[model samples]
Target: MGIKNRLTVMSFLQFFVWGAWLITVGNYWFGTKGWSGAEFGAVFSTLGIASIIMPALTGIIADRWINAEKLYGILHILSGLAIFYIPQVDNPTLFYWVIFLAMMFYMPTISLSNSVAYNILKNNNFDVVKVFPPIRVWGTIGFIAAMWMTNLSGNKASVNMFYISGFASLVLGIYSFTLPKCPAQKSVVKNASWTEKLGLDAFKLFGTYKMALFFIFSMFLGGALQLTNMYGDTYLSDFANTPKYADSFVSKYSTIIMSISQISETLFILAIPFFLKRFGIKQVMLISMLAWVLRFGLFAYGNPGDGLWMIIMSCVVYGMAFDFFNISGSLFIETTTDFRIRSSAQGLFMMMSNGFGAFFGGIFSGIVIDKFFTHDGVRDWHNIWLSFAGYALIIAIAFAVLFKHKHYAEDVATVTH
Candidate 1:
């Protein structure tokens, strides 16, 4: 296969492995298992927990000992086995631990996939920034395709999603071995310090006031990122119980409606260079924070009738809200951090945002909905969404006031792949 074909397959299966389960797992928990909000919250928290430690560890191994492609293949195979076992397990507690382990193996591969693609593309003398996004967009397409498959097959609420994921993962794992090898590079210093050896030296960035604030707010914004993923489709589907919306198009095709976010994401990713070049990271991120406010607030007032447009708009804005902070924030890290500790720095960024942010968001948001927002099993979804919107507003204001960024014209240089 040509490099492009290989990358297309890699990209497809990369997210296919995740898509087979991530979005619809809530359906399985709520619809099939009839589990409590708290239990489900705990289950999702595993992603955050795994994010805290796994990526850096795997990154260390890839850089110093194992070949990146081999490690990526092995991890995917192991994660596939974990997903296969998911169907057999019935206990929520056991399931949580098992999924946590699976996430530990899986989360690192996200970053590893980037590394694998980067190395291969660079080896072939391709422009990474330009070439990689189109290939990576296929990952988003893969995610949407998986969601369509799960919903259409009537497997969204069953353990069958895991089976589909497991099979795809197995194929991807075997295919990985055939790719160009990404052997580990020897360290320049044989007797590096423990911190340098493990890449823990990246933590020293915490001493810089501006970078510290950026990371801290990144955590808060990260909390908002998972909220839509956890509940957006389920929230829309909730209208199914109401007589007025029972037969609505959205109720029947919630996953497809949800996919507008991914479609929007592809467009936004393409536009990143223009926005970064024009606005700089600080202002761009501020726009992202405000965009989240619109994302949730529109959801608060939206329903299946006249309000459906608001919901769709919210999904549309999510592309900016997510890509602005995530991709832009990553680029910001790349620009600010030293080359030696860059990988570890990026891992730390993920740890704060996705790891800690998601853990707290899942548990707290669930508690708020169950305890304070629920009145007789039916949620006060409007108020819940409003509260989220309010949170976004506050975070945006705080970020604008506290973090000062000086925009350098040259800083906006477009990265060509």
Candidate 2:
């Protein structure tokens, strides 16, 4: 296989492991397991916790010691094993710990995969901005395929979805060792603080003006990102509560409907290079923030009947809402930072966005939903979605006002060669 093709396989399996369970797990948790909303929120918080603690640490390991590809393989193997053991846990609290452990192993691999792909692509004289997205789109396809597999096979709410995730993860873990080497870049640690010595200097990104604002907004948008993942599928399925929609195709196939978001991702992922090159990262991201507003607003008013298009439209908008920030943000970090700290920098981005963003988003959203949205054992999902839409809008306006980055063609040109 070509190097890009090889990286593409890695990307495909990388997210496939995540997709098999991520969107559907809410269904499994709330529907099959009958867990409380508050507890389920804690369950999602595991993603944030592990992301906060592990990514930068693992990036440091990859930066200073192990090969990025090797480190990635080891982590995936661990994630596979840990996730495979999840079906055996009976208590929600124990389930939380187990998921936390699995995520600690799993989450770091996400950033590591980007690092490995970037390393291999750059080494082979590929233009990263032009080349990476096409390969990355396969990751979304892998995610879509996995979701369909789980849903079509009647496994969306079953323990088997985890099995599906675990098995793909293990295979990818084994496959990773064969990829091109991405060696530790820092030759020596010297003349620096403890954070620098420990390869944590990426944390210093917050000290700068533009990057600080950028990351802050990224964190806020990251919160919006999970709002859908945590509830999109569950929301569609919940229409069953309305007798008129009880036997509707949506309730029967909510997972499939939700997969449209990932499918939308494929096209949007391809468009990112054009968007980034034309509009620059700041405007592109601002557009993404606005898309999030539409994403939630549509969902707030969407239903299984006449409003079905609104629901479908929400999923469509999800494509731009998701890809604009994540891919562009990572690429922006790639072009601007010192290459020695590449992996660490990516980890830091993940920390701010997925770490702090996800942690607080999960915990607080759950509490708010339980306290305000849930009434008499039923959730007011319509208002719940509108509240989320309002939050995204606030962030969009703030980002437009405060964050500043002029799009010079040369800014992105750094990696284009």
Q: How does each model score on lDDT?
A: 0.83, 0.92
| Candidate 2 per-residue lDDT over residues 1-417, each given as its tens digit | 889889999999999999999999989999899989998888888888888999888989999889999999999999999999999988899999999999999999988999999999999999999999999999999999999999999999999999999999999999999999999976765677787778877878889999888888878888887888998899999999999999999999999999999999999999998999899999999999999999999999999999999999999999999999899999999998988888998998888789889988999999999999999878899999999999999999999999877788778879754
Candidate 1: C-alpha lDDT: 0.83
Worst 10 residues of 2 by lDDT: 185-194
Error of 1 at 320 (Å): 1.1
User: Which candidate has the top score in TM-score?
Assistant: 2
Q: For candidate 1, lDDT tens digit of each residue in 201-260?
A: 778888999989998998899889889888887788788989999999888778778888
Report how far residue 295 has shifted in candidate 1, in Å. 1.0
Best prediction by lDDT: 2
Worst 10 residues of 1 by lDDT: 408-417
